[model samples]
Target: MPDGQEVHYGDYVQDDRVHKAVYADQAVYESELDNIFHKKWIYIGHESQVPNPGDYWTTWVGKERMIMSRGSDGAVHVLYNRCPHRGSLICNNEHGNAGKAFRCPYHAWQFYMDGSVRQVPMKQGYDGVIDYKDPQFSMVRAERQGNYRGFIFASLSTEGEDLETYLGQGARAAFDDICNRSPQGEAEIVANCFRIIQHSNWKIFLENQLDAVHPSITHHSTGDAAAAMQKKYKDKTGDDAPMGYQFLADFTLPFEKWDSLQTVGFPNGHTQLTGYMGLRPRDPVTLAHEAALTDAYGAERMDEILSTNVHHVIVYPCLSVQPPLQQLRAVRPLGPNKTLTEIWHFRLKGAPDGIYERALAYYYHVNSPSTMVNADDLNNFRAIQEGLAMVGGGDWVSLHRNAGQDTVDNGVTHSVTGMSEMPMRNMFAAWKQFMTEGN
Candidate 1:
């Protein structure tokens, strides 16, 4: 249907705008999967998801099904989820303990947690027919895998920059900020996560993550209602309303306030938005958490850790991390017009229960599929997909907001205004490079 012609990345991507075909063309989407997701460091499940030997969580890397398993030796292994024998999926459920090894439900061919061949059913039948001990008979391991803090990422291709070099300072700060907040300097994933199938391209979701201008307009109703209720509750009870109300109310912030914030973009497409939420309150729970942090890390260190003002960090092409809130959303592109997002929340290892509760509140109130905030975003994503598919109105999606006004320092670009489209432009620049260079 695409005239059997190759889609040129340069023809579609421009300095301040990109063609809608990038979002709606099947060929472009397939190219993105091959050139970007498969080649880049895509996030797998967190190490905490499989804390014990034989524990595993299934996820996707590009179009490949993958398993993140903890081996008996206390090492985490990323393996192809497909069984070597007959090529059936080894783990059907999202996550479960495989006990000692993974056995293919189809053929009973067993593989170790580290993806080494353990046993083959009826080995005598294949004595001369095939060598079951060959590595080919074992579940294939990922070409490259790395962990930052507790988060795990795997690249299908062996070639490319190492994980740390790829992450750069901006993305590294995401994990550092989250883990450093805890007294134990560690964070653990919650048992389960919220999975969403957004009816739009994955890039739309990522673009919205740092889009400072859309919140006050797209979420105006929800924010206004929450702010009104916050006042009503305060007037009635003579006390501050719960943080949940404040979370929604913050979206009603004026455009000037949003513009005052700063967004920084890295060469690798990672971007960060300065924090807008007041996370450090003088409440009893906050004070208790601060005391615990101060005891673990001296008073000055605690202040420095808590003072890191980052609201969201996009580990481009894969994860959108809100370090301050302990929230991460991983994007899996299902198709040109479909995307899957896995929403996960983390708990500070030695933080006060109230701190975890606060993260939980944000998770349920903002990130969960049932929340109005998420629903609004989902609706917009679907609408955007539908609109981009049309041929009449416009072929280009504008990224002209505050264009050419960004400051560049040492290869990183800093937006002059938070409302600038620097993040989107930064991402598309990386997209073009990845698509054209096949990196």
Candidate 2:
């Protein structure tokens, strides 16, 4: 487990498997909410989403309603989205600029963009009863907030590791890669996101993110169909097929090649699988994109940036981030069995038109609701959850593949084979720490 000075909760979890109750027990789920979601810093939204003062977006840390917004003075603040006066929600909309401040719709109690109390209509009524200037009467801000590059995260608990420490070595390069590709070194949230509610445990989705062994099986049909279409398109046009088509087909990559890929298990339950998608086609748009990247970061740096082969980085417990495609899926656990995942994609700030188009295509085709790829995964997750809930199910879930073979260096674990269960083990390792720590 992690060698932090603080007591480790992960000692209870064994290396190769975890107790089945971790998934099906309500008490464990509640504990996870308190320890993992409440204690750890969670990604809310980018500062770019609310670039202007008064702009806010509402999200969650467990069941707690939280808002990330830009204050009047331009600093970003993450606050609980509840009105202190009567517990009315301060911000009802998913995202929008509040003009200057937030006004609760139910009671009309207002708060500044920074969550400070602005007005109380019945202040005279409370003049003799209570002190309005007290912190309890003001809208509550998140206990701790931090940002990495442009990505912002908030922690409900005042204790525990800071954001940089929490991200450890597993922080997504997609942020640095995307933002640095721009002349200004920044990326902005483009409007809203595509939200999805999965009828399964949130862990299922997180575990699948770095499971290099699943795509070729779960998405084989979509991949085979895309491969067929890709070949047909090239045969007729006598030129390279569109990258998106090949991107879909690559889902059916041969087992041997899939096994050869690598999954890196970083500290704090974060894990990443490397293998770049073959999305660069020899088309006018792609050529233009290459030129733009070369112009912005120079050819050597551009090659280094584009050559980054990260497929997915599972920021354990809350997010599955695909930085290469500017994609993030924020996990919200609804119950022991139900979870909601918000699928969001971003445009690289100051990048070329074709670059954004490539990301958008992947978003729509692979991650979007209409995609067969997503539907297949959702169905599998639901089935797995149902199976796990059964009385006849096994007591422990296995993560035994290449379990003892993982090599550790500087607290990071690298699976010897792509099919290794190192990702799952690494996550459970953190889970144990979170669940058992300080209890």
Best by TM-score: 1
Task: State each model's C-alpha RMSD to the native.
Answer: 1.7, 3.6
Candidate 2 total steric clashes: 6
- List model 2 lDDT by residue over 247-314, tens digit each: 78878888788788898888789888886566455767657766777888788887777677777888
Model 2, C-alpha of 388: deviation from truth (Å): 0.7
Q: Using Cα atoms with residue i matched to residue i, what is each candidate's TM-score against the true structure?
A: 0.97, 0.93
lDDT of 1: 0.92
| Local accuracy of candidate 1 as per-residue lDDT tens digits, 1-439 | 2223655676788889999989998888989999999999999978999989999998898899999999999999999999888899999989999999999999899999999889987789998898888888989999999999888999999899999999999899999999999999999999877899999999999999999999998999999999999999999999989889999999989999998999999978899999988899899898998999999999999999999999999998999999989999999988999898999999999999999999998998898877878788889999999999998897899999989898899989999998899999999988988898852
- Residue 251's lDDT within candidate 1 is 90
Range of the 10 consecutive residues with the lowest summed lDDT in candidate 1: 1-10
lDDT of 2 at 152: 93
